[model samples]
Target: MKEGWTWRLPCALASALLLAACSGGGARDNPDDSVLHQDIASGRAGAEVTFDGTLRADPQPVGTHEHLTVTTPAGDVLEVDHNTSLAPWVPAHAGDHVIVHGELYIDPGPRAGVHCTHAHTSSGCPRPGWVELGGNYYE
Candidate 1:
């Protein structure tokens, strides 16, 4: 009886640890936003990039897109246009940190941002994209 109890205890503890790790409870690695800066400096557009930032505001639905602003660690503010027509809207709020993977676009004018944040890859969106908030990925 004693040997059985000892083995069960270790097994239970190991299972608990594995469950926490799989549940995304541990610290997540910070995303590199510097690539985005490089893209902007090189006048690059329509490039797929991954970065992290803080939400500047709640998501607003416009046409078929869910638009939101994000402030990067380097203080660069960018507009994130997630297409709701292709995927679900991200449930993010102001001040929430999020990881974004999308295609970057810089207009001829002053505005520059990212779009094509969806899971499906099509002609319009060659590379799949997603937004990570609180361990959940919304594409």
Candidate 2:
């Protein structure tokens, strides 16, 4: 009887392990790689990243910054804040596709964003970022 129970214990353990694998092996430490909700992980403040997205709206003025909303190819919606002096000079519009390289910040509602597209006089700022559109680059 004890020998039969020993086999049952091993079978139960194997079932649990199989179930864990089927359920994604529990939660990941970071889920930025998932296309459905990648922004939450990838948008850690101060990290540099480059991605392609379609402009969802015209640049809006947010105080001294120029803000643009975009939809990533992976279906993530992100906002961009341009604080460089050239913010007003960089033209963008809805439906335009753009390639962007920048430091990402997590913002409420909008979630991910890029800012500090130019050199910062202070230390500990994110590296300069850039936006490339239609053969032109703006930083």
Alpha carbon deviation, residue 54, candidate 1 (Å): 0.5
lDDT of 2 by residue, 2-84 (tens): 65897899899999999998878743222232432354565466666677778998888777778878787677777877775
Q: Each candidate's TM vs. the true structure?
A: 0.76, 0.63
RMSD of each: 6.3, 14.1
Segments of candidate 1 deviating more than 4 angstroms: 1-30
What is the per-residue lDDT of model 1 for residues 24-48, given as tens digits with 9 covering 90 to 100?
A: 8844445678888888778789977
CA lDDT of 14 in candidate 2? 96
Which model scores highest in TM-score? 1
User: Which candidate number maximizes lDDT?
Assistant: 1
Clashing pairs in 1: none
